[model samples]
Target: MNQSSSQSSNRSLPDSEYYRAFLDRDSNYDGIFFAGVRSTGIFCRPTCSARKPKLENCEFFATAQDALLAGYRPCKRCHPTDHPGSTSPLIKELITLVESDLTRRWKDQDLRARGIDPTTARRQFKSRFGMTFVAYARARRMGEGLKTIRSGERVIDAQIDSGYESGSGFRDAFSKMMGSPPSGNVAHTLKAEWIDTPLGPMIALADESALHLLEFVDRPGLETEILRLRQKHGLAILPGRTPITELLESELASYFRGQLQEFTTPLHLYGSDFQKSVLKILQQIPYGETWTYAQQSEALGNPKAIRAVARANGMNQIPILIPCHRVIGSDGKLTGYSGGLARKEWLLDLEKRRKS
Candidate 1:
């Protein structure tokens, strides 16, 4: 943080150390520079492009916010700012640069022509975003593609418009995402991960940073909800798993086995605004007690949203962590969950057992 450290930090690290970290997706450097992968047309933090980068091609930057300000975008999984790079003055510049030209593909040659050292750009990006520029760019494109899909555009169109060459190529890109085929192939969609828990094996999903869903298979309404998610996201579930899901397995297992009371891991909550509002209230419910929908609605300041609140509970993507099971009916009956009624009962009883 001193002047010499600042000056040295402005210079790029040797490719050996710089690109290696990008390939590794090391989280310790999330606020570092961004890497833009040429092959994928995405930019990432130094911690991204997990597949590795060649010595000749790796670009370095001192900040992801800078690389992004240089017109690069964020890698989905290697989220730089949501982790803390936002604390820098450079992050604001990156936001403007990328948002201004999201459609333009970034290239190292382009940087060099502009008097920017692409390799040094990698160091800067790695220093901030935790990856090189190209890695971040590719992730940004994928994100736009998902948004396009969510907006009711066709996947093929989303792909072509986003800079990919074909639907197969798009599918391959998505495989790197939610770990599933396109939702059109529901039976084969790999939208979530299933893990063993002390209470029972549970299924969970995420795009990268967010926890999409976490529930017991036997829980009521889970199947239908999964199908709904498929149609909504135009994505299928892939067989891949993320560290968050692994953590979810361990934490929920401990919670159900009656050994833990709090969950601090990150959660991916995807839904409507109402659902999000309901989730915020649910997260505040005490671990040992429960709240009726009437109580929850009252807390949210919308007495009429009680049923809406229940619907949001059913729509919750991160269950136990969000603690939707804590919401009850006016009659004190455990309400609906994408997970089964029986599992809800089991979880409630399990929490009680732990409290006792």
Candidate 2:
């Protein structure tokens, strides 16, 4: 049974064939098998767009455990094992059924007719997706509705397109989620765009020169942030992207690869003056090096302000671009990071490997 399971869920390939796939770095093979490169001694999914290694310089493993057993670890992007566990056959069937009919919302009565327990199904789905099935379905339908409106369709056209018949019902939902009516306007004139990142999705807004907002998909207080932007600018942000989006994506990829030593692109910094000073000091720490809070405070010419430095570091608005991760605790521990300490360690290690 163990052997059969491995073969059925084979996420990796043999060393010889794995090298070929690794050389390609194609998205088609991602999440199947984890590939470990002998050259860098790093394991990654096939879709990792980072620079490919030579055929002979790569190794492969079927599972993350196998990779780690052979002295490799998990890759960040693709989040190989980050998904929820496989559901029961019935839940799988329910998911498949709902997926087939995206135009129509699945209701509890529909599940009862199929002899499925709606409450149990709801719990299982929420356990995996962090939201109830109905919530996700509603979000999906709303996304479709938004797309239709963006394409110059009438409000009623968009509502019907999303499987909703009542315009008022749709209007209430839109206002609750996005804080405005159906129009996805931004700046009364400025543009906004959505780009997928390794961590999650980012909704970025920019002008001709600088990127103003780059919020993560699951950022705490994200809804509050959006409302703040709307009230301050007298406009609404829609899901969209501009030409500079491509530049930001490329540079972020490079930064992940340790190829980028600094972010030269214009950044519209937002934060208190103390936070700004701390962030600037963080940038000067250089790639692959680090500083403690006490060290950072000393550099700021206020040796007694170590706690203030730490607090300021916590509020650094721009993460990777500002390089607040280069600041650790005086105890040499990887300290607080808004993006999580694991990511902080990962970035620091990535930079160190590049210096090597």
Candidate 3:
């Protein structure tokens, strides 16, 4: 493949065109190029709300790495390193508020009291997290209560700490979330944490030791995937972080920064033996490399199982770590990716750029 063409495609538009988009704060231009402000020595997405730099002071680059290589730091306000157009300011604010008070029962009235429109909050949260803001807060509260109960606190105290006034109410909510009533003796729990990346926001589900699932938050059927994981493992998945998740988050940060190539975070594969073998092969795919489905199938010692290999690739739960995005069509074109083809392209571009 012509690597020069690939680089050119990423920045096909002329500088004048990019400058116009930068001036307009066009969301469409986001991730297409980053604008580095010469005066401020910072790079930002086209949709960055920070005051625009003068035309003479602006320089454009195809990727965040390019901007950094040009000696420009990322803009703190716009977070150009994050996935362009994936998160909104409101979502960030609400997440911060929820984190600040995990035990707070957030009602629609409470949202209004905080000068946030409840409907907007619900819409934005649903769009970003596949759940409404209220649901997200409730899950957080339940997680906090679970942590308290696991620490040997009385059930009543746990309920009160979760802002539930009545034991029955707490039990009902807990049962709905956990598939059963909580108990102090409960041994296994899965924690879910949201991870932001240059491609998008991803949801990570893990226990104390190993990561179980990781997928882009906007991936189709993500909620169903979480439910299936809960049912399959018979574990209550809560909105919290575990040691594995913390490690994965740090690894992802480094990965996106082009400082890490191999992911060493432990993972627990939940699939049939055949599917597990397929995923293992995906990991063996070298960084900054591409493989056809036929190649993967052959690597699995089943040359005729190309279609089966593709099916297993589709079922992969972990993306970048498993490197499913590295698999392409025999025709040398991109194929299906759970995170969307655009993200798939971005990841490939990022790897290739870093490798070069």
Candidate 4:
């Protein structure tokens, strides 16, 4: 199966695609990839069949041995460590050192000081995890921050415990996931997390009020949208979870599984009244059905607002749930979408297939 080389980090499965497979426990991908759950600190084959972990808690590795090398223990049920290759003694020792000093930032020079070839370590880690060892270590540190916060520790305490000396760095990192400032006493703040999908990874932001944003990783102007939402709503977006996040994750998994046709997750919309009206028109777009910009404009009682309708569609931060992709050109040609035209096509095709 020449699995090792082919499954290198660059050639690894896309997070979104692999996440769908993992959710389904697809046996075809069993030997091709392993999933590491940050919350449990365990790795499992794709077909593990255990209760699926939250999307934010997952990291993918190309091999079971790599999972072990990255400091995750193999799942007892999946027996990922029982796979073909054995972890080299050197790699095992390296992993041990990494786990022991997870709070300390690691550098290639540190490996060299220990008589290990820095290039070898970098290549091995990159091949397996699609990132350099230093990157993996930093992610581990961030994971620690998540744990501290999840355990009910205050944000400031978690920042120090996660080895951050600067308050701004900790706040920035934490806000991007948790969607609330370390000192925020704000209520109903949406927590944002990334989930891998077949097209690519998508970000989901939610709070007790409603699901706020769901945009693809490659969506154009995504950062702009995030910033605007944060500033306008005074919400801090970080990498944590809430009850709504769990609900959205489950609904999204079912959406991909073809078991869910519509989303019932509550949503917190942010925009001008006109934009809200435009989004409302978009939401009325039925499953497997599409509307043209002109059609939408007329429906909104402003037939002359065709261009405005199109602009609103482009500005939509929420994609599938709002059904922005269902708005096409008057000529029935697919038009501009923040998630890209190709995704628009795929979403339409998926709806069509499921409709039959």
Q: Candidate 2: lDDT of 189? A: 33
Q: Give candidate 2 misplaced runs (Cα > 4 Å).
A: 1-161, 164-190, 233-235
Local distance difference test, candidate 3 = 0.72
In order, what lDDT does every prediction score?
0.59, 0.59, 0.72, 0.67
* Per-residue accuracy of model 2 over 32-102 as CA lDDT, tens digit each: 56766654545677767668877655655554434433323335444333332233565457545744544
Which ten residues in a row are the worst by lDDT in model 1? 1-10
Error of 2 at 223 (Å): 2.3
Write out the backbone clash pairs for model 2: 11-32, 11-33, 12-33, 192-240, 193-240, 193-241, 194-240
Model 4's lDDT to the true fold?
0.67
CA lDDT for candidate 2 = 0.59
State the RMSD for candidate 1.
19.6
Off by over 4 Å in 4: 1-164, 167-188
Ten consecutive residues with minimal summed lDDT in candidate 4?
A: 1-10
Clashes of each: 78, 7, 0, 17
TM-score quality measure for candidate 1: 0.45
| CA displacement after TM-score superposition, residue 208 of candidate 4 (Å) | 1.0
Model 1 lDDT vs. the true structure? Answer: 0.59
lDDT of 1 by residue, 67-158 (tens): 43222355556555544534443443444455554444578886677676778766666665465565555434334423322223444555
lDDT of 1 at 35: 65
TM-score of 3: 0.54
Number of backbone clashes in candidate 2: 7
Cα lDDT of model 3 by residue, 164-216, tens digit = 56635544444443444335554567765656465544667788899988986
